[model samples]
Target: MVFSWRKKKPRSFNGDKKKELEIPRHFLCPITLDLMKDPVTLSSGITYDRESIEKWLDDGNFTCPVSNQVLRSFDQIPNHSLRKMIQDWCVENRSYGVERIPTPRIPVSSAEVSEVLFSIMDSTRRLDQCACLDSLHKLKKWGLESERNKRCMVANAAAAGAIAAAFDAFAGESVDKNINVLEEILFVINWMFPLTEQAQLYIGSQASLHCIALFLKSEDLSLKQNAITVLAELLSCNQKYTQALTTIDGINKTLFHFINKPICPSITKPSLTLIYDIVSLSNENTTTEFINMGLIPLLLEIMIDSQKAICEKALALIDQLCETEQGRGFAYDDALAMPVLVKKILRVSELATEYSVSAIWKLSKGDEKALMEALQFGAFQKLLLLIQVGCNDKTKEKATELLKLLNPYRPGLECIDSLDFKNIKRSF
Candidate 1:
């Protein structure tokens, strides 16, 4: 009876009941604190979850202890503070031997992979937006890694990405705003240069070269041509890159392998064009290396089998070398110059006759013996046939002009004109 006077000590429910009695203004989920599970998202883009309300009340997030509606959705939650607390807890747990988890491996579908690559290329286009050239440079590396670090995969992806980027950049503008991007792409390609053997095989020789040659077809032809010309110029200046060119096993194989392949009509022209450019560079050592790699035979084969443009380009390159001091030294023992000229004259007989006449004109500029040898090889007959072909009137005039030049001396003059150059037209 006296216990009743003590008020029964309020029948204490232990500290657990006191701890559970607290409430809060806004509740958060125990797992994801900003909102509760199964949130009711509103038209205003707000979310509410019952579990978050319960946790907030249990954790004293609500101010009213007896009122269950103390939580309000309009009231902002302490998301930032809660996030920091959780992060600190994670750090502490990690320190206590809870190993940090790695990102789960994403199983990317092929389509997703393609979309990601497209997005990357799109971002790469905004090269100026990037903080540094290194940012743009890393794109290729990322793409390569996505392709599983396999060289073929990397090269194929890079080639495709580079080509697409170049096309998009050059599509409409003449100023080439994307030149910097293109240069970065080329820089990446140059990094792969040492690995060109794998690339060439992966993309095939023709496709590989075609991709490289895309720079040549840029709308800015000067820029395009300059890219190629600079490399030659560099090889001319720096013996190191030139030596690299000389020792490039891939290029050597590409240049030399074409020789033994049968000269089909379809391939004849391009093969010759490639050879022309390869030989025309200013690098004497590289040129010499090409020559020593048996380029003369290839040139001869092209001269005999190629189209007019191919032949002209090839002959001009040869003419350039034949006029050089180094060229003459190289040609001293090699019958490449004379025999090629003779064979061309005999083959096309009419078309080549003009080239032969021009060749003699060029040879006469320096080596009289070369001129005489050209003439003795029925050069006069070929020249007359050129006039007889009934070609453009300008070509006929050129033939007449060459005839006059060859016979500057009276005896030679009479011998050539005595053949009745004008009447020779009807005989053919």
Candidate 2:
């Protein structure tokens, strides 16, 4: 049976096409007239679904829907009796294909949030791993139920504080065994974002961020991405966080670890983006460290197989990294670097191709091996083709310079004839 916005007619087993099962009027919200999944009574003593009343109030209506009187107070109490009655009715009408509404969860309250966070912090402190996991799981359930529940937890002092404390307890311990416990805590913390003052005091600390960065090595892809995302959120809160990120021990190496391993794009995008941002803040010493930690090879790895967006991200980062000698030297040492850069010249987006061309110009400057690598990979042919297709002035200059270098190597190379790029479709 079709459900109209104003009313519902769940089909009954009697199978009379036009016959409708009569529903009790009190079971419906006054505003929607649909069955109330979570009934609540307002200050006017008029009942409505909790979701409907909240939206009504959000829409700036302080008057009761039924009484049309200005509500003196906005407090809404759950109508448990009516909600139970509705559940019972839905059960009795199961043959009519109505789904019994699952009992509505009690919304998270500040005091209850404090209690759960206390459990997590206390259990972890005592090393009672099972009890700690149970409490974190409980809090995670509430946090996942609704946005309202998340706001309540974020408002609680213990919520973010305890999460930071829990991680502190296991900071340097081997993560392989506690990955499950870590995942649960991390997910709930993720929900409590736009960190409040209390939350930021703990999560924004360098100690806490270092602990969170440990999960970048997690073999579990989703968990690793969650860790990266959490880091991104916290780091975004303070520009100085990037400066702090560079100082953490093995932090750069761990971040580079996942980039070398080609995970899904969801993981790669944020991971690479964060890496790029952090490196952008690097001084001379930090830039050398990132290169030594496999930043160059990892970027080549990403550019080799990634889609347009990720490929462009990798190229852009490489272009920035190439500004330093260590970046250019490290990239030159990789045999695949020139070929990868040359291949991307005209294949990816205009910006990606431009970055590719620029990096090639920057890396091959006054270098024999780099220039030969570009020539060996047919960079000369691609460069000529890029110019004939009409590039930005800067790119045209770079492409023209690359052509001059390659001309000595492959002077016979010319743009491919009659190239109708209008029909040449690229996934990237």
Leading candidate by TM-score = 2
Positional deviation of residue 122's Cα in model 1 after best superposition, in angstroms: 6.0
Candidate 2 overall Cα lDDT vs. reference?
0.77
Q: In candidate 2, how many Å is residue 23 off?
A: 6.1
Q: Any runs in candidate 2 off by more than 4 Å, and if so which?
A: 1-34, 44-46, 52-71, 115-137, 169-184, 196-201, 204-210, 218-223, 239-250, 289-312, 326-428
How does residue 1 of candidate 1 score in lDDT? 15
Q: Using Cα atoms with residue i matched to residue i, what is each candidate's TM-score against the true structure?
A: 0.37, 0.65
Give the per-residue lDDT digits (tens) of candidate 1, residues 1-428: 12122232211112323232221223333223332223332222334443343344446554322232344443333234434443444354453443322222222234443554455456546543233244444545554543333233234544444433433343223224545654554544433333333233322223223433455445553444433443333333333333334343455445345444633433334444444455554367666766676665556566766666667656655655554465555544456666567545433434454554455455555565665655555555665665665555644665676566556432552223234333443322
lDDT of 1 at 108: 28
lDDT of 2 by residue, 91-141 (tens): 987766677998998777778888888888788788666788899887778
Q: Which candidate tops lDDT?
A: 2
